[model samples]
Target: MEKTYLTTDELAKKIKYDCRTIRERLKDSVLIEGVHYFRPFGGRKILYIWEVIEQDMRVSGHGFGIPMANGEVCHG
Candidate 1:
């Protein structure tokens, strides 16, 4: 199956998140490299895998804790 790859801006639009937030808060924390995103041709351009991201978003965080902006759960 073909995968939907998205740039940072496109991902931001689709996910209703700011590009800066995705870059600073969610990039490495929630959206993991290789699994959720990647740099094509070993270059600086990063493309996010939409399917994986959407899937994870739908099934994230079963335990009790407030989801923080940085992707870490706050116990308090």
Candidate 2:
């Protein structure tokens, strides 16, 4: 199956997030390696897998009493 791979800037545009935020904040914490993105040829370029991320975003419930940037998990 051919997957939809996206560049960091392309992902930022599609998701309405700043590229810097993705690289600095979301890359390792929220977005994971292999599943969310990959380094092609094990080189320095990052390519995000859009389908996996989109599906996870729908299920993760990110803003609904979830974990916050300051390392706090909101419990209802």
Candidate 3:
């Protein structure tokens, strides 16, 4: 399958979040490295995998108390 790689700004636009939030907050806290995003060719540019992030976000319930893959929800 062809992978869809999105830049921080593109991901922010798709998810309706600020690029800064994605860069500073979501990068490592929730959207883990390698799984959700990565530095292309080991460079400084970060590219996010839409499928993985979207799946995690959907399962995350957007902080709406929805259950995750591990049967947990965000309480805040």
Best by lDDT: 1
What is the lDDT of every predicted structure here? 0.82, 0.80, 0.75
Relative to the true structure, candidate 2 reaches a TM of: 0.79
Model 2 regions more than 4 Å off:
63-76
Q: Candidate 1 deviates by what RMSD?
A: 3.5
Q: What global local distance difference test value does model 3 have?
A: 0.75
**Collision count of model 2:** 0
Weakest 10 consecutive residues of candidate 2 by summed lDDT: 63-72
Q: How large an RMSD does model 2 have?
A: 3.1
Error of 1 at 61 (Å): 6.4
Per residue, candidate 3 scores C-alpha lDDT tens digits across 1-76 of 5779999989878888788867766667677898988897899999899988777767866532422455344556
Evaluate residue 41 in candidate 2 and report its C-alpha lDDT on the 0 to 100 scale.
Answer: 98
Q: Per-prediction RMSD in angstroms?
A: 3.5, 3.1, 5.5
In order of appearance, the predictions have TM-scores of: 0.81, 0.79, 0.78
Candidate 2: tens digits of C-alpha lDDT, residues 1-76: 5689999999989888889878877787777898799999999999999988888777866632344568444645
**Comparing 2 and 3 by TM-score, which wins?**
2
Q: What is candidate 1's lDDT per residue for 1-76, written digit by digit as tens?
A: 7899999999989977788978877778778999999999999999999988887867764322344855785656
Model 1 weakest lDDT span, ten residues long? 61-70
